[model samples]
Target: MNKKIRFSDINMMNDYQEERWGYRVFELAVTNILNDELLQKKFPSLNEAFFQKVDEIIAPLQLLLYPVISCFSKDPDVLSQWRAYADDGRGFALGFNGVALNSMPVTLLEVEYDQKIQIEEMKTALLAAHIRNLESGNDFGSQFRTDCQLIGAWKVGFKNSAFREEKEVRSLHMLDVCVDGDRPRLVDAGGEALGKEVNGEQVGYRVQDGAIIAYVDIPIPHLDNAPLIQEVWVGPKNINGIGNIVYFMSECGLKDYAIHQSKASYR
Candidate 1:
């Protein structure tokens, strides 16, 4: 007989609490890097260094749908949906150290100043912190990488045609995470066999602590119609570690309407 599982039986709070410890440390590092008085004084209005660092760290993960922004709809439903996506097991938290940085504020700030000096400074600082943390044996990013390798791979994109049209018209963006050296491969949620394709050339990356880091920008236009992404299977070769690979996928929606409203009010 199969036993029933209840939400009470699951320790969701404990899970989040445990993850928050590492997230807090990372956050502190990011804050220090971005808010450095010297850095700010040099850049004047925006922090370009900080934004650069953020991009370096996140760019590899291929999760962000758009550049960081601030303006966001106050709609509770929208916020709730975002929260659910972030909390979902197949969300960004599982990988990248369980630190889910909301794109709303970042995107707003970026567009406000066209990702000026301040944003670049912030990105640089964040990337520095991430590298430092990794080299210093923090293991947060490393752990997340390991988790991602185990979970395999998955894909994410929009569903409704209207959403896709709006996004394309407004230049909607998405990211893809490819592991296991450089060979291009695709798999479904059920671990079923799909197809493979060879890209131009494979760039070599160092595998540290059984984790490899690489970056690529693959535009997935097909995903615009189907936004529902549950899980993914990373290729076998990408699964470097002994245990399972943790897969995480996320899509960022640019609130063009919100930005338009903000501009209109200011005008």
Candidate 2:
């Protein structure tokens, strides 16, 4: 009932197929840029300094900024989703307004499950950098930060092809690991740090599945003080009926929101 959205650390995700794939994708992109004969021929000016600078940008991206993920899906009432994600059809799927939800300070991306598309996106970003360098000449450093940010978000959105049916949309936010306990810390390009966070969103911890999970709560904003939730679908195996669920929703401060029981016959 805190009226906040929780984005948990990607490290806590149970999807082993996608774990550490972000860093792997970035590394593969770097290797392709350096050794791919076609790309090497196209961007001959990409010297050691360019890669060194990229390495500098990636270090902090890998270590300092922890990727936090909040996942949503377009489908609200799929049987597989209910069986796999909803405690075997005993939970609920929250439906949120896409426009209002994405207005928050995070990169919202559609999850790509095709391996070929994932590889191409990484390669395309590298080629885009080459083009920018050609236009800007020696000023490529100006775009490195933005490039890293794109890579950070892009790298995390690729999932295994098996998950394509989920049609997941993920909100990815990078949290600085160096931030002071309860106080925000900023690290400069030269590695200097120590500063207060302007927004004051604090990190929290919870124990899940025998492991400690770290997350940050983003305060949900109400539009004209209206409820942000659009609807919720109760799972098929949920023991509680709609009446009790409606009462729970009221206690959670939601009003006039539509609630539906899962149509799946799965028990």
Candidate 3:
């Protein structure tokens, strides 16, 4: 099907939100990494610069791999995962994640947050960025205008109801243990640890406030989850650009997408 993948608007988005809406958890992390100070002035706070980087990555991929979340609750605990996800006062133009995008329902049913979300059982890392060296960009969360910045997944449990407001909110756990990345460190997780692997033999991590951060010697991984916006998902008008992106990505030897698929077998 030739579908139009779009960054939605207020009116149309309200419709999606009322139904089922989703956001790419990695998108926020990629945005922060793109604006890294180490990259010098390559990334500016300006919309053009930011989006250009975003489009560069998206222009090349197969959109089918990109997933989003829909039917999210307005509960404060849920919103705390990425506080800046909404509220302009936070920082950056995050309208895309909020009102703009829609999730692929087929993919979403597999990772439903309410299906007994916990630390060990959660093997998939929604988003992970490495903090190589002390100055590594783990602080990207702080730069992005969010109070809660941690390397963890949103542990969710919910109760459904006919009435939206009457629905029960059970839990949202931003679970993470801080380690010292200054030495050899291994966060014993099968797939939930999405960030790039460290190269140093001795490093450590520590959880301060509510975030998990580390300092290491390896080249920190920028963002972990598979990105949204692929050529397969794009409209016909942009096929040519997407084609070129695919070609370039192949020629440049970009890393192939190797994300963990959900094991949930639903009826």
Candidate 4:
């Protein structure tokens, strides 16, 4: 007979899944917000406000993203635990985790304010709403309170993610950018510098929109073994010639490059 795999056993195998699970929780909250009829009726502009709040909240919440991802990725056993709770059709298992449900009332307050559009008026409205819900003593009202608390916790996770921590020194490369029919330039920490006459310079080249451009090679010592190259583009198109640069970084073992910024294009 085959033995059932315990949640603990799965968790030990892959721990990063916990973070992913947290994201799932966040998604559930979003769904609830979208589906809440009373919430929608109370705040006719709920959709816009909800999304706007989500954007404002995401940066702070990002701190939790990686940890939750890591938790689930590092442990497969945790999934079993989550699945056991979600065995019912709902895909969410509500347990009394004792997470405070009313600590951060900003989102709720915002919802109330949005309805009244007046500070003092909204405060009175929210107080009345809270009292009315409490007085009902119904399961629906209780669940509504629970959902609000869960959303608050999710926000806390996001705020926590925004806090900075010490990061390990990693190798990074610099790519000099040059434009056609103009002087060559290199970019570094200080800024862009025009190229002077130099012998035995190994220039790197990349094709952009079918035009081959030249780059001066500065072998970054720390990043010598680093496979990624961070390219800073200088243009004959501009006075400084350093218009846009691309930074190539690694995330989750995948090589990716981003166009950091760009200048206004002529023509």
Candidate 5:
């Protein structure tokens, strides 16, 4: 059967259950061991052919979309925190060790910030770096050089600026477990009800692409900080080695989304 594992954020969720989930679409796909036959029957393409029931590509059952943030290594401290997280998967104790950093290889590159930006506004400039990376491609920033997934992005920056750096990730919130017993009910990334709650009837949104769009503004303590109005697609870096079962958003796919959104809003 052509089963579409639709996200609760954009579907009827006809036979779903009542509960919260903490994982991304890619993660869930690996967890469920998505059925390859069904997936190919669903989303067939040249790109779709490359994905097999393997380490990175499983059976293609994941059905949620997340943002991919671009990371800019501009400061020593920022790089250090990222290294710590990447090396030990202990991101300031933020439940962010989704990938086993020690087992996999890492490549770090550093690019300079414009001296014209001024040191005082360095924080703001950094935020801009992330936004620019996501909205546009970062020709001036460091490269991740690997396919990774973004898991948790809820963090504080500035002195801990590395937390704000854009990274790849592999999961999101939906039913980590089958809630309805027969079929799993997917919810928003935050686990909010996808549709309006009612005893006999219900009301909700079904626009898949109309999922929630958030813009976070974190203020930093500094002098040269520019007025940052960031609309970046922030996601976690999906490193290698934590589990052979992990999957994540492709960098190219995310860039397409970011570029489309930027043109609609800014261009």
Candidate 6:
């Protein structure tokens, strides 16, 4: 009766610009800092060598655990969302309970698309990483690595302004691969197959557009006396009727949820 939710790789997302914009912002911030004479004079510790070191640490994290994300749109019935994501009005849009979503052990945050804000955030993370590196006396760069992981995960949440209209709130989690002898295993945030297993499979991978995409199925707990799912919006081109939807929901043991028809006139 418990359903598992899948979070896909940010890089393998439908949007080609996913996470690329954030990296560009990071690059731009570092470039500006390195070029500015007054800034370099003020913070002599943050030189090219320091930036390169930070990049070296961060690059592996980015490659190894490129933050898998589950995105939820604030507007459930937008025309563009339906067309771009939902098989051009043929699929259904599920509305989840925000309160229930927040209750789960996940990193749920709103996506930032503003270039100016992203640049500032990138700069701040870089400065913090540098400070952490300087303070780590015995453990070496361990604290910096931990800080970079958080910052790297944060970078995945930064999308381009073009996707700003989606008004997305994303659940971010990292997927790390550890090679043990012959086989490679996927590790999640908490290391328990990224939380839990689904149907004896902790993680699942499928080929999409000739590329293998990895996803983890996290169990969605049924809230006590509350519905985890709020509603289901039938897409514009969907031919299913009210009776069919009601029957499906009933058979699935889903209760206290409404079904609405999308108002979009797309054929």
The number of the candidate with the highest TM-score is 6
In order, candidate lDDTs are 0.28, 0.73, 0.28, 0.29, 0.25, 0.77
Q: Model 6, 1-267: lDDT tens per residue?
A: 466578887779878987667678878889877887887787788888887766776667765765777899988899999998899999899998876776554678888889888888888888878777777752436687777677766777788888888999998766667676988777665432334432323667889989999887676656788787789999999989888888888887887888888999999
Model 5 lDDT on a 0 to 1 scale: 0.25
Off by over 4 Å in 4: 1-13, 63-267
Instruction: Sort all candidates by TM-score, best to worst.
Output: 6, 2, 4, 1, 3, 5
Angstrom error at residue 69, model 6 = 2.0
TM-score of each: 0.20, 0.82, 0.19, 0.22, 0.17, 0.85
Q: Give the backbone clash total of model 6.
A: 0
Residue 230 lDDT, candidate 1, scale 0-100? 27
Q: lDDT tens digits, residues 1-267, model 1?
A: 111111110112212332233233334445665577885666443355434444354434423121111112222122222333334222221111001112111111111112233334434544555455456565546643443322111111111222221121111121222444875532111111113332322222344456553322221222223322222222212323312222212123311111101111110
| Residues 1-267 of candidate 3: C-alpha lDDT, one tens digit per residue | 122222111112222332121123334434444555654353234234434433343333222111112333333222222232333122111111221122211111223333223222322221121212113453333422221121121211212222234232211111122346654223322111133232222234455555554322212122325332222212112223545645754564443422121121211
RMSD of 4: 24.8
Over 4 Å off, model 6: 35-42, 134-140, 189-201
Error of 6 at 267 (Å): 1.7
TM-score (C-alpha, index-matched) for candidate 5: 0.17
Worst 10 residues of 3 by lDDT: 91-100
lDDT of 6 at 75: 89
Per-residue lDDT, model 1, residue 2, is: 13
Q: For every model in order, what is the number of clashing pairs?
A: 52, 0, 28, 29, 21, 0
